[model samples]
Target: MLRRLAAALLSVLLVVLAPVAAQAFVWARSSDALTLDPHVANEGPTVALIQNIYEGLTERDRAGRLGPLLAVSWRMLPEEPTVWEFKLRGGVTFQDGSRFSADDVVFSYRRAKQPNSGFSDYFASVVAIEKVDDLTVRIRTRGPNPAFVENTPAIFIMSKAWSERNGAAQIPDNATTDANFANAHANGTGAFVLVSRQPHVRTELRRNEAYWNRGHVALGIANLTYRPIPRASARVAELLSGAVDFLQDVPIQDLPRLRAQSGLTVTSGVENRTIFLGFDVASQAPRGTEAGGRNPFADLRVRRAMNIAIDRDQIQRVVMRGEALPSGIIIPPLVNGWTGELDTPPPFAPARARQLLAEAGYPEGFATTLYCPNDRYVYGEETCRALVLMLGRVGIRVKLVAQPQAEQSSALRRTPGPDLFLAGWGSPTYDSEQVFSSLYHSRDGQRGAYNATGYSDLQADEMIGKLSSEIDGGRRDALIARLWQKLRGDLIYLPLYHQMLSYAMKEAYDIPVDVSNMPKLKLVAAPTR
Candidate 1:
């Protein structure tokens, strides 16, 4: 009995003496990264996940402001107005311990401009990339690129040594099932190292002990687990059960209950993303539409009718749970060149919509399928269902074909793709040029990589190209305003609403919600232990 009591006393002492466990943050959301390859998919979830692993010459902070990452400084040469030079950071090493240099920057630029890369549009104005020295590179544009600095954050850099050794020089095409070493593995110079990745399920990352900027940023999260719980109910349950420490995409309907729940901290902000609808405007015979061998979306009146039919207020209330800001234009108010007049949504008038449809030679509107991702945007599927009901009221019959984001993205990229689809665009550059070039411009060369709607105008394309080269800020803004005014009349896209983002986490942790909706957890300070 004396020996047992002594043993119990020793165990208690040992427990009290042990140090606190390292902070392991578990972040859960509804969608997973599409690929491990940083340059393959220009998708939000994929980009956010890869950002923790890979980094660019520049990065956007939580407030959507441009800042340096791999590069120490950058400037435009006064003598050579077309050339912008960047000074690379020294002593920075990749996760594999390989040294980073100008060669890697040049190599990454070339790779990102590959035909299969979704980020090709970002380099459309680049005339050449020249490495000046071991730590400096010069980017020569077709002209004086006003938007070049803002666009740098989207161009993630990769290790030249790693890519060559692993034969990942080319980005894998998501449209096809093309797989490369980069598709499954990664070697980047970021604050975190990818430990394991299971597509559509879970991914794990650990903090980089030898991170170059560890002193500058917080390295609180030692171990990070990313869980992609597709179902909203399951995601909330995981957070409530203490299985996940952070939840990124909280369902709108559950916001009240989650806020009232004990031991939880919830913060919300307006997101930079704008959810909108697009159609195959250029297709003569679009797929999934019963337009009697003609494209109804090609008609201006039909497009306008469909646009005004969607009640933004109703959707904001029912589908978004009063959490969304109604928008009339595709670009959110956060983006440059956005004006109050352009953002004011059109009046909801089903009667006028029916009249426009009748004028377009469709008295009892045609049937079409609305393709939308079930797990992409906030209330993506539910919004499409509501759209179906709303359009039906205006005599348009819509069959909802909601699928996973991966399948939906693939379908949208196909030539002569779906007739009607729901899509969201976030301006990483915070400029109207990004929206015009990627969404409205014709799919020629590298300009319209994401222009699935097939909407094109030569004048608009010229203006978009000029926006990249225009040096004067006022002139650029004028050009953007002109484009918005023209595009609104063209009716290429039906603006829905700007998404509002909410992040939920345990009281111990504090993670800020980024306007871009891509949070960099490494910058988050350590939670109170």
Candidate 2:
């Protein structure tokens, strides 16, 4: 009887300790994804969310190293240097059970280059995509492209049959009020499958059982839920109340308090993004301006005055709370073309700025509105308010207009965007090409999707076009340096500081901060007990 009682007790204990087969992990951030269609927006939040449901030919590892995802191997042909061949992974199927093939890659490539697609800049050098076989696809470029591999990680693949059947062949325009099948539903080969999506409120997802990388990657969380809490205080309350297991965007002011709290872990790192100010350089007579008949921002003297008027060091210390690295260039140091000389900010001299404004025929300065996204970047509104005061020191009387990121993006992309706007950029390719092509290049069908500033230069455009195909490393660096020199002199943008990111989560889970500021939950490790 004693032995039977002991065995029963052991069985009960084992049953009680058995690990749960399914548990949903909840996480929160400040902003929601703008759209589910992967090709629609190249914005960080949108891309990060879609990456959970879709995949690319390549993907960065937890350590930010590029590796194979759907494609097993890839290389540029020896004889035909412009042609790149990618070998697709076999036996992999989409969430809907459709087999992935080279045809899908070709379709995705073509679809991504569509007029409505925001990722056209990455494929500007590609002449054609040809399927050599069921699993082999060759991309022919206009010239010998060297950074093609680095660019593929952002070019996510889509199912050819599924897109066609669902009428998602054309990438939905995120800037407009339009709807499509892909806007709400997703059929991807990624580790997560979209269960339901309620924009700006909540998005729920479950692990993909048919995931090809299931055994290869740690899909610890059975289900994942994401909530976009724009308010910082509300986000912290959710985390402290145990309603949220993880928080992606930890407010800088709350970091010290949260770090001192128990049952929580806070991790931080520098993000590969730069926040800056832009002007409507192409507009002849921009809106919300006090200038008469002529665009004040079009004057080089006026742009230079605005650039040097603001003190970057003061902003980094006070506004950013020392969570940023003051940068002179747009691209972060992690990118290939960054140099110490290029990263040095101009001297902070309000007197000189005033003189320049006076020389530009604005002795009394002018009044214009500065549009900023409230919840997009860290302390975005605060930074813009600081700028309002800083520019006020000079003769420029400024008005601030702050709104959500969605509306801000729409305002910038529309015809004759804001007179002056605050924007941040993340170099997904970790190369200078990504920055120059998308931000500085002239507005066109293939490039300049993100050039909302309307700044256009034909000489810069030619150099940017050549940078895509230049094979020699030395020559490429020279070309990049020359372009940066011209742009720096032009002062098209007022260089701010590189952003830093921090994440707060329960101690039971460990998620590293990616340089791109997009954490991949699939690589997260959760405690069993």
Candidate 3:
């Protein structure tokens, strides 16, 4: 009955008013927000919005390499990126008028070290943080964590006094619990400021007139409001009706309608984000009576079967509506040190999937709950539904369990979850190691805000460690490909697709989104008139 309803709904949603070339536009959220703090935000939707409110130490450039953000200039004192000194850009200040300095940098680092902040691992290798002066800081790491520069993506500098005074130095398990002013607030030099948040309804933010880096190459975005519309249909309707300017995660089935509409345009390509499935290897064996506590995913054959069962092309065409590209590994082609050939996502074949399952002794299939968020990415839930349907074709009985973003994230973090789930990864840091190690490294894969899969390979971990410390670009690239192949052989994860971010907009307004895909209110290039 439900399948019939879904098929019918999909049949009618081909209409969209997206422009061929997009400009400054409205964006809709399919889920509620988790946290506004830059350090603790885990979900993509949370990032899509909060990224505008904070400035990090490093960011992805148009070419997707680690470029300085707060750090004006940096030099490696050691062969590895382990020991480096960064020269901060002078004349910078926080939103509170406190001058940005080495003190603020140290304070921010300490705050990130707290368990609640969820960003400490990005800096876990830092042996010391030495304040050089008002505009410089020297960072030293004991061991080479190769992805340090890239991991700096989430290292947003904060005012020491403002945070301590506002009681946001520590983040609670939930933002609403033990409420602090910073939970619903921000004090950054970024372009946006929070106006209000209504949980499931919407979050409004306006441009910061005093944004430190106002109008460099950024489009002139000033005022922005984002509404969390749970229903993809509702988002599209609002977009088509002129109630919204931009809506991402457009249901692929609705592309026809959006294309037919005259007032809008759609811009899409292979985004650097990847959606994948993860296994919880926290336990030595899978935890369930079905296999008597045997972790089937421990076997590479089972993992490959899951991969084979996936019809990525079909999903790309029918489910994604041609808005995405199939992917195999964690890093996309856009990032630095990306090799042209390695870990190619294999094509889907149900017969091969069944054969592998039969070899793994699960010919009849197994039942497990697939955790998914109802409103995170576009058609995120539907994508999971489609996966469940596809897996069923190969004899796997996957019961879909979808929830709100906050609840779903909390559950994944709190427990191994109901066996498996669907999630996303976008490398704002633009580092392949950061994307892979942060989620797959055993030492750090405890769901400490990043490793949702809870799957770890000791070899993969060691390779990541090696790559982290390797200083040469060519050597680093070689090590990365080897590790990627190892990950694919182990089938630690089943990657689905690389996203192509599309924004539908009215012809008059404009927003600039290229390789550095962070949506910035300050960058909304508006109509000249």
Report the C-alpha lDDT of model 1 over 287-364, residue by residue, as the tens digit: 788878888999999999988898999999888988999998988878998899999999998999999999989998
| Tens-digit per-residue lDDT, 26-133, candidate 3 | 567566557677667555677667777777777665445567778887777655556777788777777667777788888887767666555655664667888888
In model 1, the worst 10-residue window by lDDT is 15-24
TM-score of candidate 2 to 2 decimals: 0.97
> Where does candidate 3 stray beyond 4 Å?
1-26, 61-68, 78-81, 144-147, 173-179, 215-219, 282-289, 337-340, 444-449
Clashing residue pairs for model 2? none
Every model: Cα RMSD to truth: 3.6, 1.7, 10.4
Which candidate achieves the best TM-score against the true structure? 2
Please identify which of the two predictions, 2 or 3, would achieve the higher lDDT against the true structure.
Answer: 2
Question: Who is ahead in TM-score, 2 or 3?
Answer: 2
Residue 448 miss distance in model 1 (angstroms): 0.5
- Count of backbone clashes, every candidate in sequence: 0, 0, 24
Enumerate residue pairs that collide in model 1: none
